[model samples]
Target chain A: MSDLASKSVTPGRDASASAATGYRPSRTLPIVAEIRRQASRRRTQLALGFMVLLPLIILVAFEFGGGNGDDDSNGGGAFSSLVDLATSGGLNFALFCLAVSAGFLLVVVFALFAGDTVASEASWGSLRYLLAIPVPRARLLAVKLVVALGYAFLALFLLAGTGLLVGTLRYGWHPLGSTIAAQIPPGQGVLRLLGILAYLAVILLVVAGLAFLLSVLTDAALGAVGGAVLLWILSSILDQITALGSIRNALPTHYSDAWMGLLSTPVQTEDLAKGAISAIIYAVIFWGVAFFRFTRKDITS
Target chain B: MYKRQLQIVVATSDQAFLTPAAPATYTVAIDGQLTLPTLVGTPIASPAAIYWYVLGALLAVVLLGLAVLLLVRRARRRRRVTAVNAELAETPLVVTGLRKAYKDGFVAVEEIGFTVERGQVVGLLGPNGAGKTTTLRVLMGLTTPTAGEIHVFGHRLVPGAQILSRVGALVEGPGFLPHLTGHQNLEAYWRATGRPWEDARFDEALEIAGLGSSVHRRTKNYSHGMRQRLAIAQAMLGLPELLVLDEPTDGLDPPQIAEMRRVLQRYATDGRAVLVSSHLLAEVEQTCTHAVVVNKGRIVASGPVGDIVGESPSVTIDVTDVPAATEILTGLGVRSVTPDGATGLIVDMNGTPRAELVASLVRAGVGVDRVVPRRRLEDAFLALVGDNSRGSGDR
Candidate 1:
């Protein structure tokens, strides 16, 4: 190799040919590689498998239990409460499913993706090698966050699809019921559902950002994941502590259920917008602190 | 004269083994210098807290026992021999006063200084927890040094696009996605670098790594040696100006270690520098032209391997009249002479070259058949690193 060519192949440049054309490689590839790595792991496969099979298990249980014809209190039947919840414009069954899944499984999924991302590399003694490639610390954290969010979105979408399909087939397509204190016409139900998905994406992004920040702070994969989960659980607990009052609104987890407004009659969007803004704010704060600390921290261990 | 003898003793293992009685100690007299043998004394005190102290002492003893066992095994498997040739060129990469401390106040590296020059493969020789890897990481810019600076090719190392571009490194164990094939791993690295995939270069790298047909196989299936070689190949790609390899031959067998030496030597011939850190002193002697011996996060000795190993004025004479030659050489005040059974004589001289000694023996009516120089970098490294009780001596 000539001196010129050797000089061009400097570390940290990502070695993309477009660099010669004044185009830098996107900082996203490393993040994608990490995601690909995690997805290939047996643990991730098992986790995803369990998630995909969850709704089916629920459907089977409800189907078998509802067959007894125990009660007919509402217009539908024993399962009618579920269907009414879906159509009653207040905490509909579908919206309730989104909130529950997002609050529970989505937190694990985000922690699974983000919290273990950098820590796993460190534990495997691969972080030094990756960093030796001269990758900037900031870029490294960015890639990690992107990968975590990618997994979070995929998990959320899978849960939503499974819940929607089973609920529609089992309870009939009567449109989504509301969870917030608003009403919506049937014509606007589809729009509201789309809006709810977008809002959930923001909420999950915040979760992923928190997990990623924790990953930077710890070398143990379990520590990062467990710490982030603990933080989320703690925040949820504190949010429910009535004495915390308005202070709960400041917790990022508080807005996780903001999509509840999408199911409300007349579509109460105020809370949803507040939730979206809060998610974005939390994401920025979490990611910014992670990047700053990671970039400045000395990786000795 | 004695310094010269020390060098020769270090140079030839054959002489050291043959004579077995040459004085192992030599003193140097320097003007205005205090020549004190500093023996650190422990405090004389009554043994208080007997149970806890006993437990601590027992733990220390057990740990020390394990360490000695490991060292003995390592030394037996790999006999370190340092070969210094004047034929090689010298250009140094200087690292000065490097230090790194974690947030919890654990110091990983402290005030370490060393220089590795051109045409020389230098090894950072130390045991685990010796901060060898941390120094390499800082050199590679993977970790920022809390203090001190590094100059590679006269360019001060600062985190930037330009500085990182010229350096290639493999720190710690090989880093590759397990599911990806060796080729795919390289491809991913290439793509991540934003470089257009070049099939020819990729193939060449795999070939150089000796992965050959197995390059298409998933890396998870690769043996430890193969993974290490692949890591080396990745560092060698794009012909980096300076290659910093950490435990490059860690898991390799004897044959693989030899192959690694050949590969690194090939890299050195390109006028590029290679800095390899390994606990295997013998391997370092074979591969590196320079050495920076570190223990406890600081460099004890850093220089051309030849200079550090110095020259030993010992000459081995393989001749039929071994007794006659030994007597003849000793008659001239060459007190360090020993007869080798029936065939050869070993003579240790003060600052005398092999040629001069052979001529002197021949002139004194002694037949001289063969004369050769000795190589001994291993002894020097052991002497520099010393026993484990030396607390942070290098730093």
Candidate 2:
């Protein structure tokens, strides 16, 4: 002990030589890590995998049930009825698929994605460590938004791609013929497709926004995701009430039908434009509220 | 030989000696008449130029606002008197009668108040559920106190970017993205904190963490010690004025724990104040100069580490003749002599020095033996915590 003490007292030793370096306390890296983590989860992978297989299954069912010629003279048969349904610029098979995907499945997926983004960190007891680095709440929310949007878009794009592939193989990619007394030439069909994809992107953002808001309000990912989806379902049910028609326009899921306008021969731009505007407004408002609440909320629990 | 030695002394003395030089002063006299430099070629004042000036003025106002925010945050740093003086000009991080209770009204922490000096490493030592974590959360603005005010750096704890920029922390387990490599996790953390991407200090932090080439590996693969190191690394990233760590070395091996101690020591040397909470008594004893011990959500003891671990006077006498030595020590006013197995006797000298005891023992015809001071902080800490069953035989 005496020898050790003497050695410590020896002069000329540089005390700071072994100082640790590269300390960075921030949330950006953790958010990115979270994104990668969520992507690899069994449930997420399963959801994405099933989404990829859905269109093929639907197309096969359509083919086995006999082709478009099965329609009766009154357009009452399954295939012709599907065509007739498309004519209303609202309830066609294409619109049906889109509505189900966006209004229900997509909302759920987005809720799961955005809702679980931060809440998962909290549940795993990692939120304290992430916040400990002096990360401002705003920047943390921003990264979460980006990751959620990325996943939402990826899901939408994959669904759209699958739909196109199946539709082309079964009906042939001649043109996206409209039910609303419009004939889109095959040459301009791709443009309409692009417009449809863009519309879906906007619609998905609304879902993502709602999920993000729920995520910020709660620490349980399941609660946040379920809450957003429940809200979506409730809003959709409310939209069905004829007396609340005007108010229904404000519901985030109301814009799910906006892509139907893209199928018109002359391409009806009115409702599509309105829907886009509504989606943008909803996105901004939801994100603003989420950010404000996140910044102010005490994360003690 | 005498002449040569005299010559050497004269030369050495000449090299060492010097005469004091006169103080130099410079005086300048300014003319009373005011003079302006000639205007350069009729200053052009176009309407567009006026708009530009307006824009510039607006920009300057925005810039000034940003600078004020930065200054306020800097001043909020715990011990940094410069920023505190510039802003509050007095109190920095004032937590007056702070209290926090869980939803069930179970008090987790209550009435805690302490001031941290700039660049000092203060240890918060306590058993599990002692409210150290709760106290840190309140300080970081993560959890609101049930009662009382908390002023960080100098700004009142608010949900603002400026205040967070000047502080850093590592609470509980290292919350990191499992899929991300340690480096990526840190990068993401930096970006989310509103820090610039090109922060050079990040590299230094990584190096300090001893992660080396392993920083690029996913955190899921990192050992507990490595993760702890990574957490410490991430906390030190921005040279933040205030750093808070909770149970930083809970799972670390001895070497890693030592490394963490060293890293924290370096952080304090930079004039950055750190508050680290830990259950490991030995780690706190080695690293902390000041400490606050919390028990059941209340501060039981606090102050300098030396003071909290109260000094006790005892001497261990190792001699060939133990029986004789014990008898001799008892005669020297040593009230108690505890046997340390078969080899040594722990004589309670009761503030008496070894020399005096030795002389007395020698006068009594007892063979002289080696005497050593005994003051293990571990022993004192156990006593302080009221755990008498912590010694070698008992435990």
lDDT (Cα, tens digit) per residue for candidate 1, span B1-395: 01112222223345646765766755654569545567875645533335334545654765686479557735642331121222221232568799988778888887798776655688887767779988877776667778997766445664433245456788877877677788877766655554445522665567668877898899889999889888877876656667888998888888878877877776765456789998766777778888887777777777777776665566567875776776767767774886644776656776656677778777877666677554445434444555445533344
Per-model TM-score (chain A alone)? 0.78, 0.79
In model 2, where do residues sit more than 4 Å from their true spots?
A1-100, A124-133, A150-175, A179-182, A185-206, A230-289, B1-96, B149-156, B159-161, B194-203, B312-395
User: lDDT (0-100) at residue A4 of candidate 2?
Assistant: 16
lDDT, residue B70, candidate 2: 52
Candidate 1 is graded, for docking, as incorrect
Q: DockQ for each candidate? A: 0.07, 0.08
Per-residue alpha-carbon lDDT of candidate 1 for residues A1-301, written as tens digits (9 for 90 to 100): 1222233333323322111222132342466566666677776777677667776676676667655465554555323444436433322445545655766787887778878888887776666655655555656666767776776677677766776666666766654443233344445765776677777787776767788888888888898888888888998899888898899899888867656555545445556666666776677678768877887776754
TM-score of each: 0.69, 0.63
DockQ of candidate 1? 0.07
Could you give the TM-score of chain B for each candidate, in order?
Answer: 0.58, 0.61
